[model samples]
Target chain A: MKLKAPECVFSSAGFCPGCGHGLASRLVGETAEELNIVEKLVTVVDVACCSFNIDYWNFDTIMAAHGRDIPTAVGVKHVRPGCPVLAYMGDGAAYSIGMAETIHAALRNDPVTVIVINNSVFGMTGGQMAPTTLPGERTATSPKGKDPARYGTLSGVELLKGMDIAYLARAELVGVGGMAKAKRYIKKALEHQLNGDGFSLVELLSPCPTNLNLPPVKAKQFVHEEMTKYFPLGEFIDKGGDK
Target chain B: MSKVKLNIARCKGCGYCVDECPKQAISFTGRISEKGYDTIQVDDEKCIACGSCYRVCPDSVFEILV
Candidate 1:
């Protein structure tokens, strides 16, 4: 069967060719559609590469300040307790600028779905070093590659693994099988929110071909071969008890 | 037999689909797309309709007609 593209997504995503934000955004849209919550979904996106989702997605969206998406999403959830809230952001916003908000939201057990796209660089700002940038990975800011001694890499999922959040997982878009698993993880994250469970986060290891200075295909392979080694995939925590 | 439909107008020509296709049925067209990137074409005879192209494409360029 030919799966229809999610209606919540626009044809022109405004993302560069081979950028993973488009695919990640589409996965959220597809998950919302599958859950029949498209109309009631309220998305709070950070002011980074994830800002593209504010336009690409046809649902009710709010563009939050950089690294402030989680708090904004928490606020939205408080106002519309019935509506499911989704926070979309990149590695810089989630781990660098927004680390405090991200941790506290989990600490407070807020009911919202957070999707962090871990591309290992600041994509919108021309691929600067990010908290998730792998060691020895060269970025614009780290010309000689990231020094693990000076700036250690941080895994968003690993940081949150000890938290009492409802769900925590890392997924990648490396191949068809990986994409399927990514979708499944995203669906589970959203479902946790639908059940009024507190705080679900799915960190997606996505490719950045333009920023990574590699072909679109090679960028994908990098995520599989290189990124996965630092940030493993699989459900770190699952309190949903199987759907 | 199945087919993969292309939306040339929306294609950004990242070539992810071309490289990811297990059957190697897709190739880059010399012509550029409306978005000014090199677009791709699929050889119908070689396509197995595994839907690999549909999953990997950043843009929603491919639709599998099974």
Candidate 2:
């Protein structure tokens, strides 16, 4: 039997060739469609690569300044308490500039779903090194590779280790299996918010082939082989509804 | 046999479908898409319509007919 394709209203997104943000955005749209929340979902997008998705997804979306998506989403949730709110951000916006906002939201248990595309590089600004950049991985800023001895690689999800978070998980978008897992994690994070569970976050290890200076196929392999070594995938916390 | 269709105009030729196809049924055509990228062509006889391409394609370029 043929599976029903997700009804993404936009025929195409403006993302570059082989960019995982398009796939991640589609998965989130699919989840919203599956849950029948497309009409009631509100999105707060940060001013990074993720901001481009406002045109791709057919939902009520608000653009937030760099690293302020969490606060904007929190405010949206307060005004539209009956609807589900999602904050979409890239690693540069979420892990680096918006780290404090993300941490406070997780700590306060704000009823919002946060999706972080941890592509390790600042893809929009010409592949600059991000906080989530892997150790020894070269980028525009880290031309000689990231030296952990000088600057430590930060794991954003790990910051919520002892905090009271509703749901926290990390998944990559590489092969079929990885994509499937990412869909599940994204759906679950959204579900938690609909069920009135506290702040939920799903960090997706997406690929940036153009920025990474690798072919699209090899970029997916790099995600599975090299990226996973630094950022392991799995559920870190789940204290929301029964799974 | 299941049928596979490609939206040649929409494809970016990233080869995600080619890499993920379990049957090795998908390949890039030498012909360039309107977008100026090599588009993929599916070998229908080899395709099982497993939907791996449908699932992994970031561009929503494939449609599987069962």
Candidate 3:
């Protein structure tokens, strides 16, 4: 068994050390390869850390305006219905600034796959407190740590649940088990697109070591231990799967 | 026996793979990579090709050949 890097993954990425965007993009590439949709893949990335996927993945990519990736992907799908369009964004883009677009896409059940990298902070910019920022989590903006009463957290999966989407799930990238589960969820989301099912979204709990001010190892542990407690893992909704 | 290869130049020394390796087969080589971070090496004798390192590496550093 020789595990080779995905062919769709080209030159090195620009993410900071221990950033989970690299791994998340690699999983997308691998999923595209397995589904044999590389040539037909059009990724619309948000103007955040996730924009790095435009370089990491060897696919037709569009760097959309901040927090507009979902609608941008919807537009691409409208013109190129055959292409498997993916909206790649971070929690800040998907849950914060792009909240309306994100919700309406699921409400309309648009045929696009949205992968949100939830790192709990505004990664590319300074480490500001994002919508997904855990209560008591320290960020640049929340120097004293996020206050639950003052600033509550938002869970993408929770907001999108009960919608008529094709699939919905959340997974992390902490250990081998988590990564494996994330790949499975991602592959399923892409499969739903090929099947022409409505919208699909997979929120990946990733580590922002630079923003969290933790070392790589500790960041991984933080997501595995602390983040999962708030945003539990597993498929929240699988319309196509057996109930 | 199995082997894990490294793309030494692209490494950022995040040490995710080093910590994820269940066999404890990988370690920092003390030599700096082109990225100016300590590069890691694998002990082939201790490696079991579990692919944990390959799965956890953010930079795609390891390729496991069994």
Candidate 4:
């Protein structure tokens, strides 16, 4: 299947200077199509910056209110029956505002695939903080930097693994190596959803220098360093294994 | 006697290979591809065929015929 034939084009149509979101999003869309999920794809975008992705997508894309993308996707999955869905959102919407929806969806084992773009800070909302913000990280909200003593632990992969979801992975789009592994996880997630299993979420530690107030290169290095320390790279849970 | 291959598209023109070449065989004159990415070139004589370029590229653009 010729997959890049999506309904969007042009670099400006969907990407930041060094945003790995575009790379991961295109791969997901194209891979889903190759796996025959495009025709059945009903992407639910949240109130986060990914809302613009709705306009750039070629499949059934919908703009949902803050933190409600999960239920919206679940609703679409329940009604559409066999249609595959990819619920893409940023950390702010998924881990913070949408936490309730995420938990319920996972608890009920909704047949939906989720693509969580964890750029650490809320890129769209003025580079503020998010639950997934790395420790000792400085954000617009956390101007003094994130204090672990007050915030506690933060790891989306670990958090989701505790949910008992059918498929879950936390990877990065930092480089070609990471992108390659992420592509495999995306393909697997779509198949899991289409096959009528529980929830599948792929948390991508994306780069957002524009928001993070760092150069693109430095931002990427942050993912490979600080971010990877808290979240840690590799498959946190796959087919329900510790590895 | 060995194979040295490359994916020119992935070469980001960083010149990491040019500086690190112990043989001083690699030279980059800023020639870019249709993809607008500057690629690396090899001065075959200076190349000891040690595969340093293969080791350095983050994209793994270099391939050595083992």
Candidate 5:
């Protein structure tokens, strides 16, 4: 019998060497496998890097429009009921353009699993500034650092906390241990959805060295400074009460 | 002891392993990978094989064989 590998593009078990999204995606994938959601699940991916790995992912997957992932996923759950649905998207797509769909999904208690890759920058699109980009932090568009007075506020984890979310957790994909821990949280989120509790999201603060114009190690440090300052860490809500 | 190995030819230089390493051992030589971008390299003695690199890599460059 030939053994198949875990799904996703960076199949070598190595990340982008500098990108943090790989760890976040794999954590979700591995957690999905460990929790036995692979066969019964279909992922709805967006235009970010994960879009490329949709083909390589070891599960049924679908591509949603840039900002339409949540509604597409919620629709999937409404039709199938038992199938596990995931709306995996980048920070810009999720917190910015896709905010309305995400809010309504949670408001209606949609059971689709959502994982937002909050790497601060619109990593896939030339690192343009994103709503989640911390105030006064630099990006391609915000090269001089984000200006709160000019750009408005930046917050995702807090925004989710305001909704009737079931299981909302935020973790950093900084290092090996942190990455593994983050994966475990993703597994738990899927478990919650499998139980039909409601909206579940894992806000992952990851590194983007290329966009940050920093080395990988230094990128990790930037994640510590920039990502954590806004995203924070740990479980923000558990309406299910058990987990 | 077992360790992880990387393939430079197939590497797309996504940098998933660089920050995924528990010991913080992975790095780039600043030379372009076959697919472009500086490539990822790991220090064998430093990797603990928590499989973090394997878990998050979009490029799939890690090989953990004993």
Candidate 6:
């Protein structure tokens, strides 16, 4: 099947080599275009490498402070209830700094789509250890490898497991099959918002080759082998039209 | 048959297309581009236009024409 390039991403992204942010952003752009919501789409980006997407996406984009993207997205949704609001953030911003905002939004069933790119490290800040960093993973902050005893890993999806979320899923962007699955999760998350079904979150496991201190090919392999071992891929919750 | 095209200049030498290619049709040309990254070359005879490279590439370097 021939897939059309997403025109919404008009310019090339400035992410690192083999970084998953580009692919994740492209999937969101493509989904917004496919759903015909490009005109009514408002994206709130957190202060991370993902925020650079503002330069590429051709939508009403807002840059929010670190960990404040969810609240900003809530405000946008309130002002423009008819528009589909998407909050794009990284693991550090979403899970560490904005953890409370993320949970409360899900608890209240806020009508917004939250796209979290979990690359296990803070890409923009030179690969610091993030809340989603896997145990034993080595980062700049944890040069000796992550210590599960002190710096434990947290699962955002698991935190909202029993909540009444419209949709919650995690997918890896390592290979073509995984990329296809991530695209489906992203589209489903946006569909929930367009349908006014309440809160949705799609966490994508991506690679940070530069931060991971590995070549792009090896970083992709790391995501498929090591990262997925801790953050499994699949739909954790899907209260959408199909179900 | 479907074909693959690469914008070598935009390539970051990630080799994602090489790893994802089921036919092992993509390989680095050992020549660096102006951007200081190794460029990839496609073996047309082995490629099946599966678009696997197009899908996994973050740089938007590959175009699969059907």
Q: DockQ winner among the candidates?
A: 3
Q: DockQ, in order, for the candidates?
A: 0.74, 0.72, 0.84, 0.07, 0.33, 0.70
TM-score of chain A of 3: 0.98
CA lDDT of each prediction against the hidden true structure = 0.89, 0.88, 0.90, 0.72, 0.74, 0.88
Error of 5 at B13 (Å): 5.3
Q: What share of the true interface contacts does each candidate keep?
A: 0.66, 0.61, 0.80, 0.00, 0.28, 0.61
| DockQ, Cα level, model 6 | 0.70
Q: Model 4, which residues run further than 4 Å from truth? A: A1-14, A240-243, B1-66
Ranking by DockQ: 3, 1, 2, 6, 5, 4
Q: After superposition, how far is residue A204 of candidate 4 from its true place, in Å?
A: 0.5
Pairs in steric clash, model 1: none
Better of 2 and 5 by DockQ: 2
Tens-digit lDDT track of model 6 for A19-77: 99989888888888889988999999999798889997899999998999999999999
Cα RMSD to the true fold for all candidates: 1.3, 1.3, 1.4, 6.7, 3.8, 1.5
Q: What is the CAPRI rating of model 1's predicted complex?
A: medium
List candidate 2 segments past 4 Å from native: none
TM-score, predicted candidate 4 vs. hidden true structure: 0.75
lDDT of 4 by residue, A1-243 (tens): 111223332122334545666656666655865786566678899876688676566777888889898899988887888788788998888888888888788888888888888898888878987788877788898899889889864565676677777798888876556766888888888777766667888888888877888766677778878788888777665563332
Q: What is the TM-score of each candidate against the true structure?
A: 0.97, 0.97, 0.97, 0.75, 0.84, 0.96
Specify the highest-lDDT model's number.
Answer: 3
**Candidate 6 error regions (>4 Å):** none
Interface RMSD of each: 1.2, 1.3, 0.8, 10.1, 5.6, 1.3
lDDT tens readout by residue for model 3, B1-66: 548787878789999988988889999999987788888999998998989988988888888877
Tens digit of per-residue lDDT, candidate 1, span A1-243: 676568898776789888888888878878998999999999998997889777788999999988998999999999999999999998898999999999999999899999999999999999999889999999999999999999898988888999998999999977788889999999999888888778999999999998999988889899999999999999999895754
Better by TM-score, candidate 4 or 1: 1
Cα lDDT tens digits for candidate 3, A197-220 = 889999999999998999989999
Give the DockQ-based CAPRI class for model 5. Answer: acceptable
